[model samples]
Target: MFYWRRVGRIWPVHLVALPLGIYAFYVAAKVDIDWPGLISSVFLVQTWFPDVTPTLPGNPVTWTLSVELLFYALFPLVAPFADRMRTRWLMVATAVGLFGMYLVNWVADATLDPTMARWVMRHPLVYLPEFLLGMTMALALRRGWRLPLHPVVPLAGLFGWTYLYYQERWPFSDVVEHQMEFAMRPMVGVLSALIILAFLQREARGHRGILNNRLLVSLGLWSYSFYLVHHAISRLATYEFGRMPDNNAVLFTLIGMAVVINVICWALFTYVEEPAEKWWRKHTPKRWLDRGGETGGSALPPAPRREAETAPAPV
Candidate 1:
C-alpha cells in the first residue's frame, strides 16, 4: 500500500520517513556500545566497509528497500508491457523465466563458487519475481481467473514455512546442507501467490473473508510502516527491559511489545502516510494521465487497462 502510494507521490513518503529515521538514529546514538557500527548499519553504509557487523537492525532488511527501489524505477516501463500482455500464458511465462534465472544462478554459483552469490540473490533482479507474482495474480483476477478457496493452500504454506524455519535452520544452513530449503523458496512464492489470489478473488465476488474487515484493511494500510519501524521498536523495547531469562516469558513479552508497537505505528501511518500523500499530490509537480482521458496532478497514473483499447487500430 505504501509502496503504491509512494510511487504515486514520492516526496511525501520520503517526508514521512524523516521522523522515523530520526527516531532510529536517536535510539542508536543513545545506546552505550558501538555507535559507529550502529550508524553505519542503520544507514546501510556498512555494506561498503569490511569491519562493520553484518547483522544489525537495518543492515539485514536493507535488501528489501533495494528491491522496492528497483520496482519504483522499473514500474513505469513494465506497466505498459504488463498492461498489454494480460494473458495467463504471459503470467506463467514470466514466473517460469524468473525461476529459471534463479536456477541458472544457483547452478553457476555452485560450480564456480561465486562468493557474491548471496549478494546477487539480494539484488532486485532476483526478488522482482516475487513482486511480479503478485502483480500477475492481480492481472489474472482481472481476466476472470477463479481462485481456489480451500484451506489446504494456506495451511500448507503455514506448515511449510514453519518446517523450513525449524528443520532447516535458516541463514546458518547452506544450500548444500539443506537443498530442500533452497528449493522451498519458489514454493513460498507459489504459496504467497495463492494467498493473494484467494483474497482478491473473494473481494471480487463481494465475499469478505478475513481481510476485508475495516480493521484488517487499516492494518494492511499501515503494514508498510509497521514493517519498516517494528524491528527498531522491538530492539529498543528489548534493550530497555534487558533480556528475559525464561523462554515463555521472553516470547510473551516480545509478542506483547509487537502488538503495542504495531498499533502505535498504524496510527502514525494513517495520520502521517495518508495526509502526506495527499499533500504531495496537491503540491508536487508530477502529473498523471487518468483513465477518463483527463490529466491529474497525482503521481500514480491510472490503473492498467483490463482489455485492449482499440483492436490495434487496424494497423
Candidate 2:
C-alpha cells in the first residue's frame, strides 16, 4: 500500500508531465532524448544507471524523484532499525551520515569525469547518507530532542548560508567545492528537519507563524504539482523568450511566469493528484501489502457504524 500510494500520488502527474518534459527539452535544449533513458525514467530508476544514458531524458528535475523513489523503496527496511536506536546513537548516526556524504563528495571528485561526477551527486546510493540523516533526525525528534535555536532564526541562517555557498563566498578546498555543489541537499535536509520540529514545538505551545496561515496552507497542497510542472513552464518560457532585455525584464518575466504556473498547478493538483490518491485508497483493500499503519494513505480513522442505520426498523 505504501508503494501503491506513492505510485498513485506521483505516477499520474508524472505520466502527464513526461511528454511535456520531453517537448520542453526538445524546445529548450534541442536534444533528441534517448529511448533507453526514457525507459529508466518510466521505471523511476534512471539515476541508477546514469553512466549508460542521461537519467533526465524527460525532465532534469525529475532526477530527484528517482532518488526519492529509491528512498521510498528502502524506508520500510530502514525504519525499523532507525526506530530502535537511542537518541544519543541517533545523533551520532546523523553526524556519521553527514560526514559520509562529504567522503562521497571527495571520492567522486577524485575519480569520476565531470558528467559522471554530476550523475554521482544525484545517484541514490550517494544520497543514502542524506536520507539516513533525515531518518536519524526524525527518530531523535520522536524521542523528544529539541533544537537549540528557534525555527525562523535557523531557517533564515540556512538560506543565508545557501546564498553564500552559491556565491562561492564559503571557503573551499577542491574536494569541498565538489562536495559543496550537492552538499546542500543533506545540509538543507538537516536544517529543514530542525525547522519542522521547532514549528511543531511552538505549535504545541499554542504559538503560530505565518506558515500556519490558511492561504499558504492551501498553496502547500498544490506544491507537488507545482514541483512537477514548474520546470516545464519555465523551460517553455525560456524557449519562447530567447533572452532578457534587462534585470527589470527578467524580474517581470519571472513574476508573470510564476502567476501562470501556479494557476496551472492549482488545476492539476485539484483535478489529478487528489482524485487519483483518493481513488486508489478507496478501491484498494486495507492492509494489502504490509501490517504497518503508514501506507501514506489518509490518516483519518474509519467512521463508526451506527447499528440502526444498517438495519430496517421493526415494521
Candidate 3:
C-alpha cells in the first residue's frame, strides 16, 4: 500500500520528466547520452551501477530519487525497530547513524575509481544514515523531546556551512571536489534534524512563522513537481539563453527563469501530481493489513501519515 501510494504520488511527474530529460540530453549534445543508462534511470536503479555509464542520462536530479527509492524500500523494515527506541536510545542511534555515515565515506574513498567513487559515495546505502537520523529525530519528537538549542543556531550553522562551501572557504575544498561534501552529510543531517524539530515544536504550539507562510507553503506543495522538472527546465533555459556577459545579467536571467519554471511547476502539480495522488487514494481501498484484520475495517479514525511517509524521499 505504501509503495503504491508513492508510485501514485511521484510516477506521473517522473514519467513526464523522463522524456523531457531525454530531450535535455539531446539538446545538450546529440551523441552524449547512453540509451542503456537512460533505461536504468527510467527504472530508478542507475545509482546501483557505476558512474561510468551515464549517471543522469534521463534526469540528472532523479539520481537522488533512485537513492530515495532504496530508502522507501527499506523504511518498512526499519520503522518498526526505530519507533520502539527510547529517547536515550535515540541519541545513541543518532551517533551510530553518523558513525555509519563516516564509515561509508571512508569505504567509498578507499575503494572505487574517482568517478565511480563519487557514485558510490552518493549511493543509497552511503546516505541511509541520514535517513536514519531523520527517523530517529521524528521518533524523538513524537516522544516529546524538546529542542536543546535555539532553532536559529542550527539553521545558521547549516546555511553557514553551505555558504562557506559555495564560497570555496571550506578547508578541504582544494584537496577534493566531492569527498569533503560527502564528509559533511552527518553535520548537515544533524542541523537539519534540529531545524525540523524546532519547526515541529513551533507548529505544535500554534506559532506562525515563515515555515507556515502561505506562499512558502504553497511552494512546498509543488516542490516535488519542481524537483522533477527543474533540471530539464534549467538546461533548456541555458541552451536557449546562452551565458550572460555579466553577473547582474546572469542573476536577472536566473530569477526570470526561476519564476517561469515555478509557474510551469505549479501547473504540473495542480494538473498532474496532485490529481494522480488523489485518484490513487480514491481508487485504492485500505489494505486489510493496515486495518489490522481481513475485514478491512477499523473503529478508530485513520491517523495522519507522517510527512516522511509522503516526502519526496530525496537525499
Candidate 4:
C-alpha cells in the first residue's frame, strides 16, 4: 500500500512535470543538458550518481525525489525492526545515527575532494538518519512520551541559526565554522523534529489555533504539486527574464510570483495528483497491499503489517 500509494501520488505530477520541464530547458531555450543526468532524472535516481545529479537535469529540483525514493524503499524494511525496539532504544539509535550523519560529512570534508565530498555528504543514505529521527519521534509519541516545549523555541532557533550562518556572525575559528557548516543539515533535522513534536503534543492535549485553519489545511493538500513545479517556473522566469535587480522590490515580485505559481498548484493538484492517486487506489490489486492475506504471494506477518499501515504523503 505504501509503495502503491506513493507511486500513484507522485508519478502523475512527475510525468507531467518532467517533459514540460525538459521542454522548458531544451526547447523553450537551447540549454545544453547531459543525457545521462536526464536519464537518471527520468528514473528519479539521479542523486545516486555524482556527475548526474544534485545537478538535476530534466527538472532542476527533482534530485529530492531521488533522496525520498531511497527512503520509501528502505522504510518498510527497517520499520518492522524499529517497531520491535523499546521507544528509548529507538530514540537512542536515532540520535546515534544523526551523530553518524555528522561524522560522515566531517570525514568526507577532511578526506575527499570537494566534488566527492559534496556527493558523499549528500548521498541519499546520508539522509536516512533524519528519517530515523522522525520515525523515532512518532514511535516515542505513540508510546506516551512528551516533554514540555514551546513551538516558538524551535522556530526562533532556526531563525537565529539562519541569521548567524548568513551573516557570518558565528564567532568561531575557520575550522569550527567548517564543522558548523557540516553540522547544519543534521541540526536542522533536530529543530524540525522539535517543531513537529511541539505542535503534535499541543494537538494531543486538545489545543487548537491558527494551524487548524481550513485555508492552511487546504494549502497543505496542494503543497506537493506546488513543490513539483515552483522551481521550474522560477527557473523559466529567470531564463526568459534575467534575475530581478537586488533590491527590496524583488520581494513583491516574489509575492506576485508565488500567487501565480499557487494558482497552477491548485489546478495540478485537483486535476492530476489527486485524481490519479484516487484512481490508483481504486484500481490497485489487493495483492500489492499484501493485506497479510492468502492473495498476497509473500504477505507480511500480521503483527508487522499492523504497525506499518499509514500511507505517508510522497513529499
**In order, how many clashes per candidate?**
1, 0, 0, 0
Q: Write the per-residue lDDT of candidate 2 for residues 231-268, one digit (tens) a residue.
A: 88787877787766766667877888888998988898
User: Per-residue lDDT tens digits of candidate 3, residues 1-315?
Assistant: 666667787687898778787888665656466778888888888888875356555788888898889888887677777765565676787789788887777677778677777777777888787777877776656655565465788899888978876776555644465655656878777878888877877776687878878999999998998898888878777788775676666787778888998998899898988888788766666563465443324222333445444232221
Using TM-score as the measure, the top candidate is 4
Runs of candidate 3 exceeding 4 Å displacement: 170-179, 285-315
- Identify the runs in model 2 with alpha carbons over 4 angstroms from their true place: 168-179, 286-315
After superposing candidate 4 on the true structure, give the runs of residues whose Cα lies further than 4 Å from its correct spot: 25-29, 169-172, 288-315
Mind sharing the TM-score for model 4? 0.88
Global lDDT of model 2:
0.73
lDDT string, candidate 1, 1-315, tens digits: 333445544334434553454455455546333556556544434344434443232334453664666677666567566756755666787678667655855764666444455544455566677767766666556555564575456757768676866775655646554455444556667776777666665566677687767988877887767766676566565567766676666787778887897787777677776777676555444333233223333333444655543122210
- My TM-score estimates for the predictions, one after another, are 0.71, 0.85, 0.85, 0.88
List the candidate 1 regions with Cα displacement exceeding 4 Å: 1-62, 108-115, 168-177, 244-246, 286-315
lDDT of each prediction vs. the true structure? 0.58, 0.73, 0.74, 0.80
Task: Provide the lowest-lDDT 10-residue window in model 4.
Answer: 295-304
